[model samples]
Target: MRTDWLGAEFDGVKLRLWVDGALSQRIVAGSPEQVLQTMLADLPVTDRPLLRSGWPDAALTPVPSAVAVAADQGRMPGLSQAAPADLMRHQPGRIRGFLTTRPDFDGVLCLIGHSTVWAHLSAGEVVSFRSFISAELFSMIRSFDALPAPADPADDGFAQALNHAMSRPAGLAADLAGLRAQVTLGQSDKAQAASRLAGLLIGAELAAARPYWLGQEVVVIGDGQWDAHYLAALASQGLSAAQADGVEMARAGLQDLWQMMQAKG
Candidate 1:
C-alpha cells in the first residue's frame, strides 16, 4: 500500500522496479507468489519442483499451525494462503517452494535461487507450507508479474512467439552498434556504456527470449560483473534463476558482440 512507486503494466506483465528509499514502505499489492502459482497450474508438465536460493540469503515464515495441511498457507505481502505449495528451503522471510501432483511427486530436484543448495528435510520438520521472501538487503524484491502462457507445441503462434523471443538478440545487436559508437565518440561513460550494452543482452537473452528457453530453466550468463550481479539478484528472487561464471558470461555477451564484429568485417 505504501511502497507504490513505479508501476508500469508492460507487455501483459505488471512490472514495478523501485529506486530510492521507497523500497521499505509497505506495498498493498497482489502477491507475486500467487501469480506464479496460477502460472504453474497451466504448466502441468512442470511436474518437478524447481528449487533454488534467492538473494540476500532470504528467510521465510511458513503458514500457521492448526491449519490443515490442505489449508492455504498465508505468506507474502497479502499474507494470504499460498497455492498449496511446500517449502523446499526455509529462512525467516524467504523460501524455495512449489507444488507437484499427478506423478506422485516423482523427484526432489535441487532447489535453486541466487544459487542452488542441497536440502535435507528432517522428519516432521514441517517444511511444507505457504511462504514469503524476506531479505534485509533485497527486501524489495516483491516483483509480481504474470508468466506468459505456455506456447502450444502444435500451434503456429507458438512459433511466432519463439520468433519474437529470438529477435531479442537481433535487437541487442542493433543497440550495441549505437552504444559502442558512443563509447568511441567519448560521448558516454565507460560504466554507462557497459551497463547499456549488458542490459540489451539481458533483455534479449534473459527476459524476452524466456518463452523459448529450452530447459524450462534458463542459465543466464553475463559478460561482466554487473551483468552477473544482475542475474544473481534475479536468481535470488523466484524469477529465472541464473548461474555466475566469468568465462561463461563473457561467451554469452561476446557471442552477440561478435555478430557486430562480423558485420564490420
Candidate 2:
C-alpha cells in the first residue's frame, strides 16, 4: 500500500518536479522529452510511482515504470484515457457542484495556470467548462525580443498596460504594435516594454474570459512569474483570487486517485 507520486509541470521552457508531496527538483534545460527522460532515469525504482501533469502532453510523456494519468482522470477511481470534456457532465452524487465568489466576481471555480485557464461551472443538473490559451500568448510576446535584464513587476507601466487591454480588449493587436513602436522610438525601455506586453496579452485573455471570472471565485495555480502576473491582473480589476501550489495540488490529486483505486478492491 505504498504510494508515491511524481508530479511535473512543463511550461514550454522549464520542467519542474514534485516528489511525494513536496518539490524535489527543477530542470531548466532540455526539451520536454529530453528532460523527462533524464529525470525519470535518475529516480529510484518504485512499484507504486505515478506521474501526472497540469497539462495534457506532460502526462503523455513516457516514464519508466510509472503510469501516466491525465489531470482530470487522476480524480477518478480507475485508470482510463477519458477526455476531460467527456467528464464535464454532472453526475449527481458522483460529481458535486459548487460556486466560488471572489471579491468582485462571482461564478463557478476557475483555475488559472501558466499557459492555460480552466473554468468549471456546475448548474443543478448540468456542468460546463471553458479553456483559454493565455500563457502561450505571453510566450509569443517574449519571443519578439529579448527583454532587458531584471524586469521589475513593480513598474507602473505593466499595470497601466494591463488595465488598458482589459478595458479595450478589441484593441489588443493594435496595442501590441504600439509596444514595438515604443521600443523602436526609444519611448519605452525594453524591460518596461516586455512587462507591458505581458500585461496586455494577459489582460486580453481576461477580457475574453470574463464569463468565467466576472463575478466568480478564482484560484491561481502554477509557478514562476507568469502565475504571479495573473494574480496581479485579477487584483487590479478588484478581483481577489486564492493561490494554490500547483505541485502540491498535482501530488495530492494523484494520491487521491491511488486511494480510490485501493478502496475499489
Candidate 3:
C-alpha cells in the first residue's frame, strides 16, 4: 500500500505486533492498518486472534496516572480525572510511557514538543500537569513574511534574549517590537533576529512554568531537536535535567499496557 504521505506531515503510522503476548516486530508506514490487514490475511486463521488498538491520546482527555498499588503489578489501580479543565491539550501517552520504564520516578517531567507538557509525578502516579504552546507559538511567529528565517544552531541571540525575558518578562511586548525593529533596520541579521525571537518566547514559557520545575528533579523527554533548548533554559536557572528518548518511552508504555491486558485475560 502507498504510505508516502505518512512521512510528509509526521512520522508515518506505527504498527506493533505481538505473538502470544510477546512483542514480535514494529513497523512504520503511511497506512499501517492497511498494511497490517494485508499481512494478517496471509496467516493461518485462528479463532482467538487478539487485535489490540494503540492508545489514542489526542482524542481522549488525560486521566490522572495510576499504577498498581500492590505487588501483582497487573491489578488495576483506581484513576481519577483531576486534570484542570483549562489544559486543552497534552500527551499522557508519553507520560505513561516514561513512567512505565521508571515506575519509581518522582519529579516533574517536561515533555517538549509542539504543545509542551510539564507533569508532576509522585508515588508512581501523575499528580498534576500543565501544557504550554511555546513551540507552536514560535512556529507561528517565524512564519510571518517580514521575519527572518530561523537562526543557525550556534547563534547566541537565543541565550541573550532568554536571559532578558527571564529577568524582564513584563517587557516582552517591547522586546518583540524591538526584534522587528532590529530586523527592519538592518542592525541584527536574520539568524540573530530569529534566535532572539525564539529566546523571548521560551523565556516567557520558563517563567510561567517556574512553579512546576522549581526545586524538583526534572527529566526532559523529547526528540533531540527541541530538547536542547529547554535544557539550556533550565540550566540558566541552575537546574539540571536528565534526557530520555520520547519515542522509546511511548513504545514502552504501550508495551506495558499490553502486558497488563494479557495478564488480566
Best-fitting candidate, measured by lDDT? 3
Candidate 3: pairs in clash: none
Superior by TM-score: candidate 1 or candidate 2: 2
Q: lDDT of model 3 at residue 181?
A: 86
Where is model 2 more than 4 Å wrong at Cα? 1-37, 54-110, 121-126, 148-153
lDDT per residue for candidate 1 within 1-265, as digits (tens), equals 2221211111111222222212111221365344444444543324332221111122443543211121111221111224455433222111111211111222212222222222222222222322212111111211211122222222333233323433555664565567567767988655454334333433343343233332434333222323343343344334564444422221222222223334554
Q: TM-score of model 3 relative to the true fold?
A: 0.72
Candidate 2 residue lDDT tens string, 65-106: 112222344322211223443221111101121211122223
TM-score of each: 0.24, 0.69, 0.72
Q: Candidate 3 regions off by >4 Å?
A: 1-63, 67-84, 88-90, 146-154
Full-model lDDT for every candidate: 0.30, 0.54, 0.64
Ten-residue region with minimum lDDT total, candidate 1: 4-13
Question: What range of 10 consecutive residues in model 2 has the weakest lDDT sum?
Answer: 88-97
